[model samples]
Target chain A: MKRKISLNPVTRLEGHGKIEIFLDQQGNVANAYLQVPELRGFEKFCEGRPAEEMARIMPRICGVCPEAHHLASVKALDALWQVEPPRPAKLLREIMCCAHFIHSHTAHFYVLAAPDFLLGPDADPARRNILGVVGKVGLETGREILKHRRYAQDIQAIIGGKATHPVTGLPGGLSKGITPGEREEILSKGKSCVEFARASLQIFEDAVLQNKRYLDLITGDVYRLESYSMGLVDDSNRLSFYDGNIRVVDQEGREFAKFAPGDYLQHVAERVEEWTYVKFPYLKNVGWRGFTDGKTSGIYRCGPLARINVTEGMATPAAREAYEKMVDTFGGKPIQATLAYHWARLVELLYAAERLVELAEDDAVLDPNVRALPTAEPGEGVGVVEAPRGTLIHHYRADREGMITGVNLIVGTTGNHAAINLSIRRAAEKLIRNGKVSRELLNMVEMVFRAYDPCLACATHSLPGRTPLEIKIYDSRGNLQERLWQ
Target chain B: MAVKKVVIGLGNPILSDDGFGIFAAREVECRLPAGAPVDVVEASLAGLKLLDFLLGYREAVIIDSVKTGSGRVGEIYCFTPEALRETVRLASVHDLNLATTLELGRMLNLPVPEQVTIFAVEVADNTTFGEGCCREVAAAIPQVAEQVLVHLGIESATG
Candidate 1:
């Protein structure tokens, strides 16, 4: 007899997804599949639009990380135009990106991921959320997190002209420049943000590290090692969020390759499966590896863990120190632990804040000329930026008349397709083999979903529904035996 | 001379009819006399940030796209601040809509024009990735522009 279990409408993440686990006659897990059911045809729709319009159109990909798309689109256009923006413009764009990182990562850690950490695995389903965290951890921390998010948005709004989708970033430079008064205000806030980030990090450390039971609750038998990792790496092999070479590292933290962003297509190939609209992107050399045991390796993880593994160190002093501490405490190797994503995110938050302060104090930031005057030149260009979730690349080709001829976008979440599916499968196998499915286990599977911090809505357009776990049993001949559909 | 009226267009042009406000603003700007008291500004949705332009004006007209089901594509809905509050749903946090923005402005105790009119064009294709307006909505542009001119007490060519 064969059995199948389906987890439909996966929750606690940005968009909709489903997981299916197949069981053989022996009641053992055979194959597990995870599917994200949304379709966002940004690349197809971008075809035949003006290259300059990419800056405006691409940001609509995600309301959460619009700044990332904006920056990447502008960079691609810059490459096409063969013009580097003024120093002030670059600094302003970087600052805006850092601010976006702080807010986005904080939201993920506190509001989305913290409930799993603080509420314990067996905590009530109803009470396992931000509100529940507030009840257990106190109102001050929750309020502080909210304040940090708002402050980050406000800073981005000042520079980019809006928080969600800022239109200020243009191809050659910014549509509007910041005043000295605005610079002073941003700097002061940047200083306070550093203190806030440090305090938040301390809270997470005390909660997760200092408390042995809490650590055991969240970590025991959760994380698994199976695939290689990818992220942005600076020339010095340090973790970098902005412009850098693409680094792919194996499970043991060995560098696979560091290639330019434009070379991504040569290495990455996307395969479409019948289960979902989200494409399975993998290292072309690995071939068609499925989620489970297969010669054709498929799903792999990206985002924070992959980023940290691929890079040797962090760029900012505070983040680098935190990274060292995390490694030392977690056995000094590439952490396969999904729970550590929160720790890595907080570290990046600190780095972003520190970097923001440094950039704000620079004299070039106050320069009156923040834009480079450039006429429309027709050509092909590529732009890459590291969004909060992962790498985002934009490619555009324009005609001699400056009209767009082609557009190809490789968003951050698409890069993590294989890993997310694999994580879901592993979690499902563990729960099904034990013959028990608790809400906590469901949440754990959801945690893997959260670990990738996927923006499914941005990746694809799909309908929303309830997330339920179902299972079925079958024989070797694909004969249905027993089933549990919930 | 008639009271100078300013019209502002809001929303992303790439998001199809989300650029309705901007389209109407541009059309109204082109129809008015060169030295007319009306100015048109193109802005992304900024809820409170719009106050900088609205202040010190005697009258201002705002043209935006409406998702309401009460009318057809070219159907025009006119409302004052008080009347708009009752009919339109103010769910957006961005200052993209004139109704909620005016309400926020009043709450912030900022200077606001005494006469404010809003022209909302019903939208059917707000999610498509393109710049030009749809055929139905595109046809309504001239009428919407004329309505704004008439509201501002200016002699429009159509009128």
Candidate 2:
């Protein structure tokens, strides 16, 4: 007696997503799917617009990661026109990106990820949230988090003009240059952010790592899956968020392929499924093996854990120390535990903050030469960056007059579609028995999904002005067992 | 002391009916008398980042789109954050939602607006990628702007 249960519109995640779990006759899990509604006609919309407008319009795709889109689009334009942004402008762009990572990762860690650990995962739905985390952590820490977040946003607002949807970058350089006074203020704030990031890691160490039960849950087979990881790396093979060649490591932590953004088509391909609008991307060399894991499956992960797993080390000293501690904690390279993504995110947070300080303190930051005018004819180009979630690639084609002819994008979350589904299936199989689906059991499933931080509505930017999360369970006879709506 | 009022238009201007709120807000900006205390801004964002537009204001009016199954297209609904707090359980997976952000703001004792109003137009098409709103949604913008003026206790020139 196989039965199906649908958690329609998975709760507490970006965009609209649903997961369906199939139960075997004995109530064991058979399969699961993470479904999302895909927004349509994006490439067609960009066809006739000027290539430069992508910097402004791309941000509207997802209000959550607009800064990533803005920068990636600008980089694509620079590549299209064959112009190089001056060193100072490049530093400015990198600093802005660092600020974005700090702001985004801070919100994710405190608001979304912390609740499960701070309050037990099985706690009442109402109490398992940021407000609940604040209650347990104390009001003072809440204020500090908000203040530091504000500081990060302020830095972006100063450099990029607005924190969320920046409009500062152009084809070859930034639209404006910063004065020495503004530089000093940003530097001072960067120093404080470094301190804040350190405190954040300490909190994780005290709250999560110290709890034996939590540690076991994090490393347990239920939450662990072996998959290849992908991220951008600099010349030294350190994690590079702004610019680098794409790197992929196998399950055994050996470099499998390293290629430039322009050569992305040579390595990655998308597999479409009828059940869901979202496309599953896999390593072309490995080929698509139907949502399975291990050395044979082409499914690979992107984002924090992947970034840390594929890279040699963190670029900044404080972040390097944190990275070393994390690797040592995991006992080696290629930590396959899905929950480790949260830990990896914190390390990147520290790196972003430390790198912000480094970039601001550089003498070159004050230089006035920021733009190099474009002279080459417009052509096809691809830009790649390590967005907070994972690797983001922006590809564009343009005529000699710089009008866009075609646009293609590979966002961070889409890369993990297959892996996310696999993790959900594994968690459900281990937890659910005899057609039993409790709130706690369902939350355990969500915990695994949350680790990927998938943005289901990566392209759809719509607001119903409310969060609608519904979960429905069914028995073997196709009868609804329980329904919860929040 | 002058009353600090901010009118925020929330939508993706390139999306079809999703741009209703932005078009309405822009109309409100145009009709307001010169030297008015209102600061009009448009954004394609929500959740914690909204605190950026909402903080440091004595009064704030936010115009956006909402999709309730029963509501008619072009219908304008006025409500407070309390209305949203009760019904919507926002989870961005990638970021915090509005209710959580507002609660966090109160916890941090940030200077969040004391009085806030939301004008959510029922939307027909928010999925398609385009610049213009649907005809019905477009027609509702000026009327919505006038309603906003009434909420502010100010007279519209047409009135």
Candidate 3:
């Protein structure tokens, strides 16, 4: 008899996901499917609005990374208006992005990922949460993460005029310029944040390298890698957070293509399925290939690991050294294991803190003229930004009156949707094939979802109603043998 | 000493009428008596963080955008903390909701104010970018500010 085990509403991640495992005659794992059940219609709704509104409206798509959307929207508007914001405005935007990176990544690592780490692989379901982690691992670390989040939000509030959905960024430039006193205050806060990030990085590194069992859990054989990876790489081939050309590289670190933000649509295309609302973005050159269907065939991964792999080295001096040392210990090639996401995230944190300090102290940042007057010209435009999760793209078409006639948004999570589902299914199959399904195995499958760091809420915000996850198993004769609903 | 009041504005200014809270908060800030102990805060929609600002005050007036079916654009609703506690369940994706944060503040023995009022402005077109407030909501800003001033026991000096 073939049995199908389904994991629905996978917890501890931004959006929702479901995993279905198909078993063979001996109950061995045959295939696994992971599906996200929400659809985002902002692209369709944005068709008739003004191009400038993209900056304002798109940010609300996700409460978590609104700044990313805001920046991308502004950039797209700039492209349409055929103007460039002043250097000071660009620097301030980078500073704001750095702050977002720190806060968002910290939230994921501590509140989301740490529960599984500190609470133990076999922790009781009731006790496997942030509150439970505080009890098990102590309050100091938890408090530190919370403090780090607050400090980062403070940076954003000061710059953007509010913490969550900032208002300072505009199409032509920033709405307000920063005063020297405010700059000094931001620099001071940033200094303390660097110290916090450094300490937290140490904690993560120790967990991965020092603890034997923890290392075993993270480097489990189930974690594997293939397909091409993509991220922002600076002109010098260094990992860049803010502005750079995108680099797509294969698993062996060979650069496949280097393209500008506006040309992303040419290299990437969206593949929609009738069963799920999430759009699977694949390399146009590679064609329709499923995950685990071979590197030459299917869609691949993006975000932190892909970012580090594509770049020659880290941007900051300290971060470059750290990356080199990490690679030396882990032994190169792409860090395929999902748990390595925590490590890659920490590496990015180090670079963000270092870069923020540099940008804060720069004199150009205190320039009085932050924003230029808006001269609206109707045209086509595209803006791309590295959201904390992955690359986010915004494209708009406007008429002479500055009204938008079309809008296309390929969010960060949509880029990782294919790999995320495949990885979850792969992990579930391994656990079920081994023996009875335990809560620990369930947590492991959920961890795979977290590893992608999905923002399902943003990817499908306008999805009309709730669509639950459904899983069905078919026998060799194509007979329905089992069904699970969530 | 007289009860001190603070006003908080929440929402994104760029998101058309989503900036209703900020608009009303600004109006209230301008209308307050020069020496009145009122501080206006522009905050993100994070409920727990908003609770932190509410602590240590005698009273607080929160202005925010709402999409309740009972109200149309420019419509305004006022509710006390007790009444809001009864009706506002937890729906936000943030760590907690406004009621739970207040309850948590009370349980922690934090300096939560005894009087808390919320001004919810009905919003339309929350998604349009770069546009000003909806026509109806834009016209109602001064009126909303006036109502807030009267409720706070401060004279509406501007009008």
Best-performing candidate as measured by TM-score: 2
Clashes (candidate 3): 2
DockQ of 1: 0.06
| Residue-by-residue lDDT tens digits, candidate 2, A270-330 | 9988888778889999999997899999999999999999999988999999999999988
RMSD in Å for candidate 1, one decimal?
7.9
Chain B structural similarity as TM-score, candidate 2: 0.93
Highest lDDT: give the candidate number: 2
Q: State the TM-score for model 2.
A: 0.96
Which stretches in model 3 have alpha-carbon errors above 4 Å? A1-4, A22-26, A374-376, A459-486, B1-159
What is residue A458's positional error in candidate 3, in angstroms?
2.3
Docking class of 2: medium
Question: Any runs in candidate 2 off by more than 4 Å, and if so which?
Answer: A457-467, A473-486, B90-94
Q: Where does candidate 1 stray beyond 4 Å?
A: A217-221, A292-300, A459-486, B1-159
Q: Give one digit per residue, the lDDT tens place, for model 3 in B92-141.
A: 23433466557655644568888788787777655544336888888878
Q: Which number leads on DockQ?
A: 2
lDDT by candidate, in order shown = 0.70, 0.86, 0.73
Say which prediction, candidate 1 or candidate 2, comes out ahead on DockQ: 2
Under CAPRI classification, how is model 3 graded? Answer: incorrect
